[model samples]
Target: MNILMMTNTYLPFVGGVERSVQIFTGEYRRLGHQVLIVAPSSSQQIPSDETGVLRVPAIQHFNGTDFSVPLPIPGILNAALKQFKPDIVHSHHPFIIGDSALRISAQLKIPIVFTFHTFYERYTHYVPGDSKALKKFVIALATGYANLCDFVFAPSLSVAVELRRRGVLSHMEIIPTGIETELFLNGDRRVARKWLGINEDVFVIGCVSRLAPEKNIDFLVLSVKKFLEKRRKVCFLLIGSGPCEDKIKANLKNEIIEGKVIMPGTVTSQPLIDCYHAMDLFVFASKTETQGLVITEAMASGVPVVALRASGVAEVIDDKKNGCIVENESCEDFVSAMNWVQGWGRKNNLKRNAINTASKYTKEICAQKALTVYEGLRRKNHILRNHSESTWETAKRLIKAEMDIIKNMTRATGMAITNK
Candidate 1:
C-alpha cells in the first residue's frame, strides 16, 4: 500500500505529534508498506539525511513559536507525487500544512485522513489577536477540516466526543499515537541515577514536557516546589525546555541551587528512557493535552503518575489504582495527590497497575489496527486523475484545490461569526 503522510512538524522538535508521525511512518514501512512523508523543509534542527520523506519550502519559527509555516508548493511537488501515486493521505494538523494536504488530496482525488491531535480552542494564545472570536474560528476551522476528511483519527475518547460536539460529521477512529513499551521498559534506574549524581535512596518526582505557557508550567512548578519544601530528600526531575524555563528555575531557585532539583533540558533516546526509570512518581498539570503521551511512557518504565483531571489524563488514571487524579486545577489538590502516591506500599501497587495500563497502547498493536483500516480504505478508494494525467491537467486540479480550501476557510469564518 502507498501511504502519503503530511504534517507541519517532524523530528528534532520533540513533541507528541512529531513523535506520532515518526513512529507511525517507521511502523508502516516495517509492515511492507511504502510511506512518503511531506513535511516543512529542513530547518537547523532537522537532519539532511531523512528517507521516505519529501521536504517543502517553509518559514521556520513563525510568530516566535516552535511551529514552521509551509510556503507555497513548488512545481517539483506535483512531479514527485505523480510518480508516488499515493492511495491515502494522512494529515496530522488542521491548518497551514493541513491546508496544503487538503489541496493535494483534492488534486489527486484520493481519500484524506485527519488526526485530531490537539484541542484548537486551547491554543488561541499563539495567534496575534487571541480573542474569543479567534478561538471560535479556530474551533470551527478544525471542525470544517475534520468534516472534509474521509476519516477522523481522534487520539482519545474525550477528543472524539469534543469533535462530535463541534460538528465533525466524518467517521471517527480512536487510534492513539502508540508508545514502544519495550523501549521504555528497558531503561536502567541505576544508570540514570548515577549519571544525574543522585543517590539510590531518594524519592524523585518527574515531569517531561515542553515548558510553555499553554502547558501550565508555572502552576506545576509552584505546586512541585510546595511539595518539595514539605519533604526531606525528595527531588524533582524536570526535563524538556521552552520559554517558561527561567520561570520554573526561579520558582524552585533555592531547591535547584541546593541540588534538590535536577533540571535536564531536553534529554532524548536512551538517556530519556533511563530518566523515566529513575523516577518514583510522574507529575503532569497540562490541561491542553489531547492524549497524555509522556504519562504512558512513564508508566511503561514502571512509574506511577499524579496528574490533573483533564481530557486524556482522566481516562487513563484510576483514582487509588494506577495513579491518583486531582479533581481540580488547584495547587493544593495537586500536591495532595502527589503526597498520596508518595506513601509506602501504595507506590508498588500503582507501579504494577500503571504498567498494565501502558501495555494496551503499544506501537505494534496500534499501528496494525490503523493499517488494517488503511488497507480497507485503499481497496475502496477512488481517484480523479489517472496514471497518465497531463501537466496542464494537474495545474488545473491544483487551482481547483485552492478554491476549495478558500471556500472551506470562508465557511469556517461564517460559522464562527454566526455561532452555529
Candidate 2:
C-alpha cells in the first residue's frame, strides 16, 4: 500500500510524536509499502533513501520549545498526492498538516486515518487568557477533523476516552506508541555508568523530557529537594533541553540542590539509553502526556519508574509492581513514593517486571497493529463506496424521516396550546 504520513514537525525536532511517526513510516517502508512523509521544513532536513520527505514552508516559533506551524500547502500536498496516489493518508495530529490531509482526503475521495498523539488541551495554559475557550475550540477542531477521517487512532485508552468526552464519536482504535526493543536491552551497568561519568555507588534519579512548563520539571525538583531533606546522598539527572533550562538551573541554585542536580543537555539515542542505564530510578511528573514514551524506554533499559498517575501512564505502569505511581501531583506524595521505592529494596524485582512489560510494546507489534487498522479502514471504505445504493441518499432519507417526526410533534403541541 502507498501511504502518506503528515505531521507538523519531523526530524531535528525530537519529541515522542515525531519519533513515533518516524518509526511508523520506517516500519511501513520495510514491509514493502511505499511511504511518503509531509512535514514542515526545519533548519535541516535529512534525506532518506527508503521513503520520500516533502517539506512545506512553516513558521518556526519558540513556545518554551522549538516547533513549527505549517501553513496550508494543499496545492503542493494535493499535487504530491496525485503523483503518489496513496491508498491511505495517515496524519499524526489535528493541527495544520493534519487539517491539510483531511481536506485532501475528502477532495481525492481516499481513506484518511488520524492518530491522536498529543493532548493539546493540557497545554492550553501556554495560550493566552481565556484558555478554557481555547481548549474548547481545540476540541471542536479535533472533533471536526476526526469525524471526517475513516478511522481515528488513539495511542492510549485514556486518549480515546477523552476524545469521546469531547464529542468525537467516530470509530476509534487504541494503539500505544512503541519502542525499539533491541536498542534498550540488558547491558553492563558499570560500563553504562562509566560512559555517563557517574559514580557506581550514588543513587541516581533522573528524568528524560523537554524542559518545558507543562512537564512540571519544577515539581520534580521540589520532590528531589524533599527527598534530600531526609536523605543526602541522592543525585538528580535531567537529560533534555528547552526554554526552561536557565530557569531550572536558577531554581536549582537558589534551592542549593545544584550539586545534586545534573543537566547533561540534549543527547541522541544511544547516549539517552545509556543515561537510563546509569540511573537507579526514573522520575517523571508530567501530566500533559498522552503516552509517556520515555517511561517505556527507561523500563526497556531495566530501570524502574516513578510517575504521576496521569493520562495513559497507568496503561504501562502497575503501581507497586513495575514502579510506584503517585496518585496525585503533590510534592509530598511524589517524595513519599520515591522514598518507598528506596525503602523496599525491591529494585531488582521492579526492574525485572518493568523489562517484562516493556517487551510487550516493541515497534514491530505497534506497526503490525496499525497496519491492521489501516486494512480495516480500506475494506470499510471499499464496501461503502461500492454499495449498490449511495450512502448519501440513505443518509438523506434518514434525516427526512427524523425531520417529519419533529414536525408532527410541533404541530400537536401548537394545537394543544390553541385549545387551551
lDDT winner among the candidates? 1
lDDT of 2 at 262: 82
Candidate 1 positional error at 241, Å = 0.7
CA lDDT, every prediction? 0.86, 0.78
Q: After aligning candidate 2 to the native by TM-score, how far in Å is the CA of 241 from where it should be?
A: 0.9
Which candidate wins on TM-score?
A: 1
Let me know the TM-score candidate 2 reaches against the reference structure: 0.87
> What is the alpha-carbon lDDT of model 2 when measured against the actual structure?
0.78
Give lDDT tens digits, candidate 2, residues 142-200.
66667666788888899889889866767888888788887897545677668666688
lDDT of 1 by residue, 150-171 (tens): 8998888998998898789999
Error of 2 at 143 (Å): 2.2
TM-score of each: 0.94, 0.87
